[model samples]
Target: MKKHGVISFGEAFIDYISKDRSNTKFTQLLGGATVNVIAGTRRLGIPSYYLCRLGVDESSLFVEKELAREKVKTEYCVRTPSKKICRVYVYLNEQGERTFHSYINPTPDEWLLESELQRDLFENAKIFYFGSGTLFHETARGTTDRALKYAKESGLLRAFDTNIRLKRWESDEQCRETILSILQEVDLVKMAEEELLFVTETSSLEAGLEKLSGLKIPFLLVTRGSKGTYAIRSGSGIFVPAVKVNAIDTTGAGDAFMAAILFGFHEKGIPENLSQLEKYTQFANEIAALSTTEIGALTALTNLQEKVQIFKWF
Candidate 1:
């Protein structure tokens, strides 16, 4: 079999989900921004690898099991009992929307240094995925930079998603600068509607799109929940409508979208024109819509293989 070519480097943590229908009592679930994306890729039949650390604690162990179940290549996963896994307390509203309150600060993932990243994996990957969570701290920021540097030197395609959590950033200015810096280097970017406003410092969608044109990223995918995605690739623009579904838990919908998009890129090279982008974006939208029909990120993904058989790519 051929080796997987997609690798994601970032934190992975346990989420204590509020089980109460009213959002009170809690239950545990695997939750990490980047991990969810990696899992989505694997579910979409894209061979992927996860690069991060985990301890022997129960939470860490749970993550280990989940990754194995997801079949993401874990050769780059480091094990150490010295640092415990990070934790996030997730509260879900009646609408199935969630708010995250994290605990166990400064956990093992924050300590992921450059030396820990696998140079060979970085060198071999066709596409490298990243989230903004690690850029908040100095240690991890330096570590992420090294991995990004490795990907760049190796000439691998780099993708970034502005999965911003205000609580994780040091300051608004710091968040803007760090994200923009990475944005400058990546071949593609995925941003939510609000993220587009913040990153472009614009109040309206049209203005934001105009500002993004300056970056000249080969592909800038701006996802508008329910409204669909806007793709700006090398100045050409295409809008793909969102697929409607009964959203139960939207926790990892964006990750699903990111995974599906990156998977499409892994399978097909960069879109040659708007028509090509529209086809891929439509398929990705369906992938993301199906993810929300269930409570967990990877829960509803078992059907992707079946869905792929029916949906032809253009």
Candidate 2:
């Protein structure tokens, strides 16, 4: 039997996130929602690839090294002639909520034109993953849109993490339109409770899930933070409570959650045949909880066997 793998499409950049109460020091880590998911999935022993562009700077080189170390293929990542790598500075509130300060680079997403895209890489992938921020700019928007169209038409399983960073978008209306348009092409969507409320303009999770389900999405995962998480398929809903953990920084928890779920499903085989969304959600929530036990997003995911051992003790 042939093995299954996922190909993630989106941006790869550095996150200059602060971890102190006095705001004394900031740390730079290789991060992007899509890349983080790929990394997290890899940590769970899943084979995946990150397809994106980065500057030919030291930071970009570090990202390449890290992805390679994680055993994730990077044949589709492009190195640009740009000045430096893109970075997002993160600020954490008292409640561990995250805020971003971004340095928008000039690397054009047109760099991902069909000439550069690894057709063989994508053609061999079982899943194609991306998020909304990649659709914010015209250059990236055009490239990702085309890639998504191709993925949908190619009969690949499409996953969308509706990672709506309001600051990156032109307007709420524009964000809705672009995201809604892309959702139609996606086979799965993972969204947070707040994002669901914001995107659907619904005050309740049930109503919000119903609205998203009406779009004909096959699998929908909704994370409700401390309250737990939910997954629905063809109107069948499954809920899993969040793992208890003292969160130091909540920045990458969602990415960890997304990756764990994908990893779980990938490990299990068929997404449509698996009625174990609840089990995956429970496992993913534990991964996300463990992620917040430390600062960096990818911290706890590194030692999966150890982490699973710890979870067993929990």
Candidate 3:
């Protein structure tokens, strides 16, 4: 049995999603990539913890309640006296695609920075996951930087999701600089096609791979929605097509994908062989595609039996 767990650091926000832009009947769901990943981990019975801040408001209260219900350890979650909560408005198209209009809270997520992060949390864990959004600001960025530095020094497996939300940053230049800095510390890097292009400043996938080859990240997983996921390490690349599902909402699919990838990595005993890596990516893509079948994130996970059944189709 794997005795370790995962510790994640990022934001926890509320998403207001609507099909019609003029309607007030929007569905309210939790909307932070880190939080969503933690939820998925909990559903898989993984011992996981999240470190983030929430305000003293109804949204915060609800989020706390939901986190507890999901069985994720909240010992590191900080509840501060801010009047606002991080928020986003998601708009979906007819094709189940999504675009967002965000309302960012001016408050910082660094309120938990002073709390002594239990070094044991990362020291004994199998993976330490972080992302770029937490580094978009100074206060939270400082906190995340310090924690990840600690995790790195302790020789923990560091995973980074280059979750690029262009609207959150001041400019593309700022995003590139901050994301590139985080890449230096990550053992595994997860990105989408557009993100790969943007991060590498290259027009083609081959060029992007060439640029990242110098980084020597142990594992690079690039997700191309619907078409499938691609995995490359050192010299080999493998493509895994997405499972066919009638997607209700694309929200949290990427987070679900990453969580499933982690689960598969743990369950299959992560291997260094190129063939083993390809096999894992195929399984991971199936889990991600299955997630989009339901409305909310992490609610409709494919169980062990279901996962086994799907592998036959692949």
Best by TM-score: 1
Q: Candidate 1: worst 10 consecutive residues by lDDT?
A: 101-110
* TM-score for predicted model 3 compared with the true structure: 0.89
Comparing 1 and 3 by TM-score, which wins?
A: 1
Q: For model 2, how does the per-residue alpha-carbon lDDT over 1-314 read when each residue is reduced to its tens digit?
A: 35368888887777777776545578778887888899888887767888877667678788888889889898777777663666777776777666665566655433455456656665666778889867888877777877776776666677889999887776999998888888777777899999898888899988887787778877888888888888887678877889998888676899999987777666664455435666777888988998888867888666787654543342
Per model, state how many residue pairs clash: 0, 0, 0
Q: What is the lDDT of residue 84 in candidate 1?
A: 80
Off by over 4 Å in 3: 1-3, 19-22, 91-99, 106-111, 114-116, 302-314
lDDT of 3 by residue, 114-213 (tens): 3446676676777788788787887767777778877788766788899998887989999998888788778788999999999989998889888888
Q: Which scores higher on lDDT, 1 or 3?
A: 1
Q: What is the lDDT of residue 228 in candidate 3?
A: 88
**True-structure lDDT of candidate 3:** 0.77
lDDT of 1 by residue, 143-226 (tens): 888888998998778889988887777688889888888888899899999998997789988999888777788888899999
Q: How many collisions between residues are there in candidate 1?
A: 0
